[model samples]
Target chain A: MFSWILLSDKKVHQAVADTVHAVTDSSAHAVAEHGAHGGDENLFTQLLHHIYDSKYLEIPFYHNPDPNKHGFELMQFEKWYGIDFSITKHVFFMWLASAVLILVLSWVARKNLKNRVPKGFGNLVEVFVVFVRDEIVLPNMGKGGLKYLPYLLTNFFFILVMNLLGLIPYGASATGNVSVTAGLAIIAFIMIQLSAIRAQGFGHYLAHLTGGVHWALWPIMIPIEVLGLFTKPFALCIRLFANMTGGHIVILALIGLIFVFKSLAVAPVSVTFALGIYMLELFVAFLQAYIFTMLTSLFMGLGMQMESHGHRH
Target chain B: MKNEENNAAGMIRSVAPYLTLGIQIAAAVVLFLFVGKYADDVLGTKPWLMVAGIVVGFAGGMIHFFREVVALSNKEEHERITKN
Candidate 1:
């Protein structure tokens, strides 16, 4: 049973095994001195706690139980980030995804740099990189946006990688977390504002608060425009966070239907919906990356235009 | 009444930018205040750091707003010169 559960991911199991060995070492010493092998009990109990109760367990959010076994169980968020944030399961997955992305991208990047025709994975990555730079970054952001292309490219690919990671069986999605999306949105917001400031001088930037209207109309229009700017990024954060989380929740709910109905009869129905949603999520993953990059570029263009106007008169 | 309407229209047009400025200032202030208040309560800070946060956020927002306006003006000037 333990070995089967650990089969979900080998590294996770090894890490758990290491932790299990560490905790059971002192206890194992006492148990061994007694000339009994019952230390297995202590090991088992520790493993169970780690699996079910410990913060370190990375249980799949969408789990369905067999009717042959004891019923269904819902994955709990409170158990993960709340009282048990120390659990390295989510953190480990995040690190693993990031490392794998960096290693793979770098490897592909180096191999394709020769002055010859690129093929295979190198070709795919190059096409993606160029498309984002030319299509997404350049058009919306205008010519001046080239300076910020690297950041936008990293953001898009990083998000794309993380989103695709969750699509892998048993892999957890980091992008589903509000904190992660909010952090990304906040960074984009900082970039947007800084670019604006850099283009326009100190005095003129504040003057934009009034929508570049003459002084007499400053009272009413300023607040609305200001709110508009802040709300744009706030909406971006919420949209990404909500969409990612909502998909996972729907999948979980669908699986739970079989357990609720107490029959395998629902499996056929549930699987169809699950597959359909799974496909939709793949598209959504790309759509979100595109939207975020496009918006950032658009904001950059607007800022540049504002800056150029500021110096005119 | 007609005079007041014209004044309101003129005010609407001119004060628009300042109003936006105030809003940007206010949003930054409110965001800081909300976060500071939450943190102070959660972290057990005495006297609540929200007041200081609001002041700091407002000042920062003003700086940001001024910078944006200047950038816009500069871009406009470049465009005009190119057109000529």
Candidate 2:
């Protein structure tokens, strides 16, 4: 089923590309007829023409003009059963990250589970797992946080892998896409609400939405509380996506300076800056993954904390 | 000794919420402004509903923001007392 979808998506992409090319070609012809002859084309006109003729940069989530021409291209389905089932680059990377995580973790688990002392890669994985459980999940969620270890651990590693993978030469960061981040945030949000409901019971959970205010003030308080729910996840989504996308944009823009100047003199400076940004991006990749996971765990913990159970104002 | 270790861990965990607070406040206000605008368009009330949206959104966002700040302060105070 997946293979068939992939095949059909490829066909759809081809059709879309063909359509774009045809439209551009017609426009170019119109311009030629109305404005500039081949020899008489001005520098600006020539530049515009070049831009038009140049294949669009093959970003992961976007449509590419040529699938065979290398770089990342999404298999566009256009529309499949009233929904677009196009397999984009981000989706592919997400799947790859999941597969890689499962394989690595399962191997680590097999090795470490049987041994009193793990060595090498298993040791490394153990260190991260322990750090997350002790420092992030346990501290935030208190004594009850142990039950949430699996979810938080999985989240941290998945995000870490996805972020790190983007630093690779040809890999795109799935988390850089708003939709992917939003999806993760939604899951976190649901977990948070579930934790709250479980801890406080349904009545108390709904009561807390009044924020301990008088019953008469509920109309005003309710909207604010509800907004609070969504704003947290929305912020989470934006924070991850923006951090990832911002770093890439900076690196790309710095590199584009070389082409813009069209001079070898600028190449060294541009490359140097781009390289620096790329290195910073690697640090940021890990930082963002850590931040996202930490925040999600904290939010979950907060939800589980009874309003009256915490320190009184 | 374990409590001391947990205290340090708690300190670290506390940092994430502050990082997100500003963004949350701004998003809340902006979201409500849009919501208000949409409501005005749908209801044909023009400026009144839009004005009400801006007021309500700002008030709610600020209230939430201040509440979080207070909660954080209180938690910090409690932690300091316990540590002492």
Candidate 3:
């Protein structure tokens, strides 16, 4: 008796194979060709020559091992999503960065609280907090900007965490994934559009979409402007995605250099680029987060500004 | 003198609006090219979608930039009227 497996270079291939083998109480070898039967790599291909198929077990991260328990084994995303999204590793990094940021900031916030004077780390963070509030959010968003501060702050910190996490050796960058960044951009897009409609009535917001052109130009401009709405958020998605991915790829390639050259001597030179890129990535982590938050504020601000000014009549 | 203030403000109004748009456009193009390089590895269909995505992205950026221009002018006019 034997077990069967699917052979593909896909990431889940191993997991699927292991599952099949664990279930079947049989020993099977992967076959490249079918027997005289004109069958392909279907269900009955190679593993059917078995008696029983038992369930495969995995080492748990931490578990009580039951579905009703706090931590269970079958939460494997690879099994469920069928795509190796590396979500756990990414989440681990995200949590690490968040934990660090919170501890440090909270310590500073606690230490710096004063009746009159601010000092040290508190002073430093205040500078950024104020800068983001004044330079980033206020100018674009206007007075209503105050309302969006919590969201803007959350965006800033979350992205800052994700970006910084990518710099760590074992950490996966969550923002490097298109889905994560896309989800963020969509949130920004919806907030901007919804607020625009609320601030300006639906009629005015729709008119804004037409770019205030003669009705003739409206035909072309409206579609373009509507496209623009999606494009800004889409650009937001790609910017964070590419920046994070690019840094990681560069670092990976630099490290790969030693392997490619097959020489220990190349290690020193490769280390230089790797270190350099990593440092740049550190700055980029902060910059990208700032840029994303700043742009979101700017868009939301513009919409609100238009609504207020347009209604002043 | 007040007119000069208005001119400077108007100038700022003109330049500031374009500033963000230009940056966004440039950024989008750079990112499009960067992702396009890895399209085959990610999407499994090679240069076709990547090339198309790049073209579409560039057009989108340019169009958005133009729209911002019109919007800015409209905004400036409204601000001027409100001042009066």
Task: For residue B16, give model 3's deviation from the true position in Å.
Answer: 7.1
- In candidate 3, the residue pairs with backbone N, CA or C atoms under 3 Å apart (3 or more residues apart, or in different chains) clash, namely A3-A47, A4-A47, A23-A53, A23-A54, A24-A53, A141-A301
Per-residue alpha-carbon lDDT of candidate 1 for residues A246-285, written as tens digits (9 for 90 to 100): 7766665564343333334455798689779989999998
Calculate model 3's interface RMSD in Å: 6.7
In model 2 chain A, the worst 10-residue window by lDDT is A48-57
Predict model 2's lDDT versus the native.
0.70
What is the C-alpha lDDT profile of model 3 across A34-140, one tens digit per residue? 22122333424243221111122222234354644322222234554665643344455556767877898788778777534677778877788787787677766
Which is better, 1 or 3, measured by DockQ? 3
Off by over 4 Å in 2: A1-75, A307-313, B1-12, B15-39, B60-83
Any runs in candidate 3 off by more than 4 Å, and if so which? A1-74, A77-87, A95-116, A210-222, A308-313, B1-84
What is the total number of backbone clashes in candidate 2? 0
Query: Which of candidates 1 and 2 reaches a greater TM-score?
Result: 2
Best by DockQ: 2
lDDT of each: 0.61, 0.70, 0.63
Predicted structure with the largest TM-score when compared to the true one: 2
Locate the minimum summed-lDDT window of 10 residues in model 1 chain B. B1-10
Q: Which candidate is the best by lDDT?
A: 2
